[model samples]
Target: MNTFERSGKHLAIQSWQKLNSKLFSGFTTREGGNSTMAFHSMNMGFHVNDDPDKVRKNRKLFSEDIGFPVENWIGSKQVHAENIVKVSKEDRGSGSLDFDTAIPDTDGLYTSDENILLTSLYADCVPLYFYAPNDNLIGLAHAGWKGTVAKIGPAMINIWQEKESVDVKSILAAIGPSIGHCCYEVDDRVINEVKVALDGDTVDTVYKKNAAGNYQLNLKKLNEILLLRAGVLPENIIVSDQCTSCQNDVFFSHRKDKGKTGRMMSYIGRKGD
Candidate 1:
């Protein structure tokens, strides 16, 4: 992954092809902006205790750095559900001022319109960006433990194929930074849920029981397998090795911060043709 400091935030790229003169995608950190302690610096999420004005300013800097209008970007309320909304130009600036009507309890957003930017909130959860070059469609989803267990990753692919005529095999996927196995200690319940969610081919490799009897799960690998099962080419998917808990200085980790932490934004949009 390549990192760059922008708007006092750290941005990472899973693949160079994900970047473009028009398409913009990045993961935000706790630097930059004007929020005070805890949510200090560039905190883009408004639901947190961070002041709304400060979040707005931080968002302004974030939007400008990515060359998009601050008021034009749309963010989901992120209910951790499997619902994926299809965005349009009419949805611009929906959640920037109000989360009620804007977000509306969705975990994923997709769009073929260039004017619409699809964004999802993430603190420690994995941010999955989907790009179908053949169909000129883009999607972004937030996958926490529950959502992952529900296999929302594959569901998103199914939606694209059914709604947008997307060719799953030609799509490219990128998994952003999140809590890794080294820090994501799980109990028997989560391990069982994961094993049940993943297929037989991936069950053995996705989780490992340590000497202490605790299970360490690799969410990145799990999602990679999900994408492959959803028909995406193995070589077309790239996962970031950056662990949020391991590298707290550059990214936000809910585990490290004990639930109070800033968020990283993962976005994908089609270029205007």
Candidate 2:
């Protein structure tokens, strides 16, 4: 029932209470960093035209606060596709220091390796987290409209089953903060894509037409439904109520900021003993 627990400048996943003590997962806020202007503070994304040094500093602050080293963080180019990559210790620090060095054309990263942090930046898109305690595996995915329609949730599930032989029902999934349906109105183009991606009942359950005739699409619920269809248990899923556009003080919103904004980082990893 609980979404995320706020500590200092970040929000830790409350469901982590049921997991191993070495497991760490959370989403960053827009506060407490060195970036200025549109990036302001805590802009952990280097591709947003923010100063690279400031982005690095912000990343360092977050890593130090979370007890994870910046040097161990792994990133991705995030083309909003369903490309999921399995990371290892050898892939550590990829995209951590810069965007060019990150995994190319990947939106989802999964690994059972300890001390390798999986990270992705977000403004209004969904950040999907998956953990299979039995397998000691963790994964993170960036699900924008394109990625969600591409079925990235199911992609992660498929990867775990194919690569790690994980039972889909045992995976714990969390949908992170993003623009909610209340403020996210989509035109026919996006609505049509969503309608095609989901079933009839699912489309009705996740989308509602407003007075202005535009549809309010619930990205979080859509992703949750996708996870459920992928066999993740209903009780094992946590959906955050926080909307980035509505709570601009605590988070960044690409739409609210008119596409000019910083990005929050969603990260998960297991610490080495």
Candidate 3:
């Protein structure tokens, strides 16, 4: 079953939204915007060669559509690494308008602060949304292969546990849409890294040997395995089965578009209606 439901402009994580009325968590699609060609429309990443003005307008339209003001949004300068930054209201508007002001070298964001919308741009990368209701903590991590092998999801759980002095079992994680195993084949190099990252843990469910001798890796499941290893309860996790590559009309896939395509945004924030 799909964890996210379409709500006009974006896919809302209904389960998360239901857990906390003030919590706002969802992902944007490659639609309802002003961008053109290569980007086409709803391109949220300013560094993706899309028109700056158009990207800005797209941000404005999305923020208005979601009812989270443009000024309350924060973005990251994602380098495909596992750096997760904890933000607050004081850090609002950092990357809302341009890339230069975005939080540097960060692929994930967390906040106990309200009114600060944390966002990360994606094109087939796994968007990991985390929430610890005991502390009202919400977070997002951009998990591409690199970030996944680096264990960014577990890293976020560890940080939040430390941040709130709470048990990791209390954390709830949602694995959003990304390139699925059916569409993602990797060479021995990536497979080797996955093996090393798991530290000799079982990977039977994470990947498989395809007919071509290459491996079809499941990034979303890989992340879930790591989260389970990190102590997040099995029932506390939900994975989105929507493959960006398969659903090209609803999402923009880097692999599907041959590296030249628009980006979707994954966001989670704490704000009241």
Best by lDDT: 2
Better of 1 and 2 by TM-score: 2
Q: Which stretches of candidate 3 lie over 4 Å from their true place?
A: none
Model 1 scores worst on lDDT over the 10 consecutive residues at: 1-10
lDDT of 3 by residue, 1-273 (tens): 689899897899999889887888989999889998888789998988888999999999998998899999999899999998888888999999999999999998888888889999889999999988888788999999999999999899888777678688788899999999999999999999999989977678899999999999999989999999899999999989999999998899999999999899999998854
> Across residues 155-209, which tens digit of lDDT does each residue of candidate 2 receive?
9998898878999888899999999998999998988788777764555668999
lDDT of 1 by residue, 1-273 (tens): 423224335564535344454666667777777887777777778787777888888888877777677667788888776888888888888787555556688888888788666777777888888887667787888899888878778988999889778888888788888889888888998887887877434476678898889988888878888888889898778787778899887666789999897776776554475
Cα lDDT for residue 192, candidate 3: 91
Cα deviation of 166 in candidate 2 (Å)?
A: 0.7
Once fitted onto the true fold, the runs of candidate 2 whose alpha carbons sit more than 4 angstroms away are none
Q: Which is superior by TM-score, 1 or 3?
A: 3
Local accuracy by lDDT, each model: 0.77, 0.91, 0.90
